[model samples]
Target: MRAAERELMARLPEGALMQRAAAGLAAACAELMGRVYGRRVVLLVGSGDNGGDALYAGARLARRGAGVTAVLLSPERTHPGGLAALRRAGGRALATRQKEDAAAVERAIRSADLVVDGIVGIGGKGGLRPDAAPLAELAEASRAAVVAVDLPSGVEADTGEVRGAAIRADLTVTFGTHKPGLLIDPAREYAGSVRLVDIGLSLPDEAEAEALQHADVAALLPVPGAESDKYRRGVVGIAAGSSRYPGAAVLAVAGALRGGAGAVRYVGPAGDAVIARFPETLVSDQGPKRAGRVQAWVVGPGAGDDAQSVAEVLAQDVPVLVDADGLRLADRDLVRARKAPTLMTPHAGEAAALLGVSRGSVEAARLHSVRELAERYGATVLLKGSTTLVASPGGGPVRVNATGTSWLATAGSGDVLSGLAGSLLAAGLSALDAGSVAAYLHGLAGRFAADGAPMGAHDVSESIRSAWRDVMS
Candidate 1:
């Protein structure tokens, strides 16, 4: 973002960039207000460019007959140009450093219709300083709608980590492009709804993180040609489930059926149960070696203590997806030794166990955890939770998925996801594409199945076709 801003600033006038940002910010504020006139807007001004943005934006609102007040945290260090502009445009400034101004500042914020959080910019890190923390709390507690400039104050611009107090904005109006923090959590949870205001900065093609849209997923989905047969389309083999947990294999097969694979072959103790549920499956009691030719294999859904099955599947030349019990039972060395693509799906708890860290630590630093695991295991890692992330072994743009709902936190959901991802892998998608695409579809399916209510793993699997259609349409 800095590079892009710098490049655009060099060709423009000294204050041109700030003016453009202020114009957009003011417009968004006005739209949010519905009627700008007679509205009370309070700006939490600091001694930085972010404060300058709020000051200039406040000046615009003042010109439109709205009552604007700038509460300056650093009285002497406030932006001279912005302060002068606000004062000239009929907006008032209150220096909060003085004890007498504290009551006035509180009153202004509490009674205001809108609060603009410009306390800290993207450059500012490690959360809000002690002096600025109170204002954030007040803004959050107030009934006024809050808007953040560039990003919510106190969030790590690149990493999405919030060490301490951070402003939870109702809307975040960012210039140039979307920052990594806005797309990821725990920072994402703070940035309610994001509005991208293009400042026309020429940015590189590469990005730190990426969120795939419908078009991207649609383009990646496999479609059969006129001459394509069931065998030519690709077959996905399932080595999951035992007598104790037959539903795991059933759910896995259910997900695989809708993953664009031509056929599904099952090899486990739950063959009878799998056949009973999904009669289309090619059931075999013989292990993965003799399970017949397959483009990909999905292992470890409910196979308890079945380390040998995990090993046998890993030894195969085909692409493999490991989930549930397979993640724990699969040998790390054997996974690293695989010549074909390997995809490991794990929730926070599974990830923590593998990384030897607390679940809270993994949840807090999801982006870092997923990348570390991918590099360590020499495979693509899909870290699933509120925001599912897919990272490659060599490192590139990590894919972030947020299409799911809280209802997706049900039993056997991971098994379905594993099967779907493996099927995508069998259908000729790379491990990276397979995992990310599967997550996207799975999340969308979850939303459809849930539909503002409770749902089961089977409901999500059944809704996959609807999700695929929605994406394709």
Candidate 2:
């Protein structure tokens, strides 16, 4: 953003970019408040461009007859021009660093109709400083609607890690482009609904991360042609389930049936169970290699200690998806040696086991953990969580899945995801695309199945067609 800002600023007039941003911010604030006039607005100003954005925006609100107050964290270092504009527009300013101004600061924030968090910008790292941490708490406790400038204060812009105190905003008005922190969670949870204010900054085609929207997913979804047959469409092989966990095989096949794959071939001890649940699935008592001609293989949902099965599936030349028990049993050396694309899906616990780190660490730093896992495994990784992330082994832009709901956290959910993703792999999408697209569809299915309530893994699988149709429409 700094580079793009520098490039744009060199061509445009001084302060024009800030003005463009402030105008949009003020407009959004006005819309949120419904009426700007007589509304009390508080700006948590710091010593940076973010503070400048809030101050300038506050000036706009003050001009429209709203009561605007600036609580400057660094009064001496505040943006001079912005302060002057606010003061000129009949807005009041209070310095929080002063011992005597604490009461006034608290009172103003508590009574305000809106609180604009400009205490820190995207450049600010770690967390809020001692002087400003209290403001974040106050904003949280207040009845006012909180809006963050660019992003919530103290979030890591490059990664979504929130080390310490960060403001929880009802809205975040960002300029130029959406920061990576704004999309990934922990920080995404801080930044509520985001409103991007374009300042005409020409950014590069490549980005650190990307999110696939409805149109993007729709474009990638496979549609059958008139001449296309079942074999041509693609067949996915499932090497999962054991004597004790036959439901895993059943659920995996359930997801695969709705996952755009023409045929699903099952090879496991749970053949009768799978056949009972899904008769269309070609059942095989033998191993993966003998499971007929499969375009791709899904291994390790409930193969419980079946190292041979996992190894056999990994040896296949076709694309392979490793999940659940497979993630643990599959050899890293064998996975790295495979010529075909390998996609590994692991939750925080599974991922931690692979990286030899605490699950908490993986959950906290999802972006880093996913990337590191992909690099270490020499394969594509889908880190499943509240925010599912797909990282490619080659390292380009990691895809973040935004369609997730909390209700999706249920038993056998990963098994369903494994089948769905493997089906996509068979349909000829790249490992990265298949993982990301499956996550997107799965999340949407979870939302539809749950629909504000709890749902089983089977319910999620049943709703995949609904999600597919919704995305296509």
Candidate 3:
């Protein structure tokens, strides 16, 4: 998989790398243009290699008979060779030095058939500098296809977190491998579609990658044999909801029902509430030990802050998903001692609590936080939020779920997700697969249920079968 460290190589001569990048970038631009002979192209050039890449690509476009123009934001520090090449290929190179110049450049952007953004790259610290900011804004307002070289300017390369403003690109021609920022959120929102360009960099070992495609997810989904019965599929015991918040228990059970588990054995205080909502669920109030054998457990969705219930769930040897209230009550070692796998699904607030930090810290550096949780707990961690991420103890690619909507912030949504994931584990998927696949489907279901309108937690749970249909179909 591709990453930031692999993309930022200093071993080779800077000029050689730029040339290779420019070649791939030009090819991508050509593919976008289809017929470059008469197209008008604008190159937004800055002061670094990103700017150089745009200039070089512009030169190639101009050589192929396209009308190319390079707007220099920083004339004094522009790439000399790149500027020379564009000029030699009959492309107009101009420098802007005024506030109104941004608008004028925007007009030029509007007139262009395509725009190449080389304003910033991995090294940029803040949002767009004064001049480049307006230019990027204007490009956003324009109709031309915007292709970012390396990554969208102002986006973090190592993490998908966006600190300040950033340009939204239609396509990003990245080098070597993928950057973590390209796969994560906020930054991922600005990156429309990512295309990898091989520069022959020997990358180091990666800790994680991103979401599994359809075929990959299909491979990971549990499939029952003809001889299989509900018992063979494994049972999931749930400790969720209460009299005051019985809806949480019902929704959690709603999620677990479709989780492919043979049966759901609910062992919480609200057994009557669970039976009332989901009569199919096997309900018990006699604690986990008497709830019959289960392959996995789901704890903490509305389980209240009662330390007793959290302690009972953690005491089980089955694979456990510690979420919501359980994240607060359960000791980390109890989870560590589990013989079966452990999965932790914590939204920003819960994750912050687990790490003893502010919620803002977890949001700002989600990639780091997820990895840290997995490493610290020795369990798979699914950090839920804008860009839900799944991190594993044994490093692979961190899967980033892209299908969630703001509407999913509705109450009880997480309870449904936790139960769904718990069921996947009971069905025999690894903790990572169970959690990631559940996140993916849950997000899709949330979107399907909402359909741009508001929805309740029950709506989301009911839509799971539809989302399942989407995957199965």
Best by TM-score: 2
What would the TM-scores of all predictions be? Answer: 0.98, 0.99, 0.86
lDDT of each: 0.94, 0.94, 0.86
lDDT (10s digit) by residue, model 3, range 332-370: 887777777989999999899899999988988899899
Worst 10 residues of 2 by lDDT: 252-261
In model 1, what lDDT does residue 309 have? 88
What does candidate 2's lDDT look like per residue over 240-358, in tens digits?
99998999999999888888889999999999999988989999987887889999999999889999999999998999999999999999999999999999999999999999999
What tens-digit string does per-residue lDDT give for candidate 1 at 1-473? Answer: 77888898999999999989999999999999999999999999988888999999999999999999999999898988999999999999998888989999999999999999998988878899999999999999899999999899998878888888999999999988888889888888888889988877899999989999999999999999999988888999999999899999999999999999999999999999999989999999999989999999999999998998899999999899999999999889999999999999999999999999999999888889999999999999999998899999998999998888889999999899999999999999999999999999999999999999999999999999999999999
Ranked by TM-score from best down, the candidates are 2, 1, 3
Where model 3 places Cα greater than 4 Å from the true spot, the runs are: 1-40, 60-67, 74-77, 96-114, 126-145, 197-207, 394-396
The per-residue C-alpha lDDT of model 2 at residue 49 equals: 97
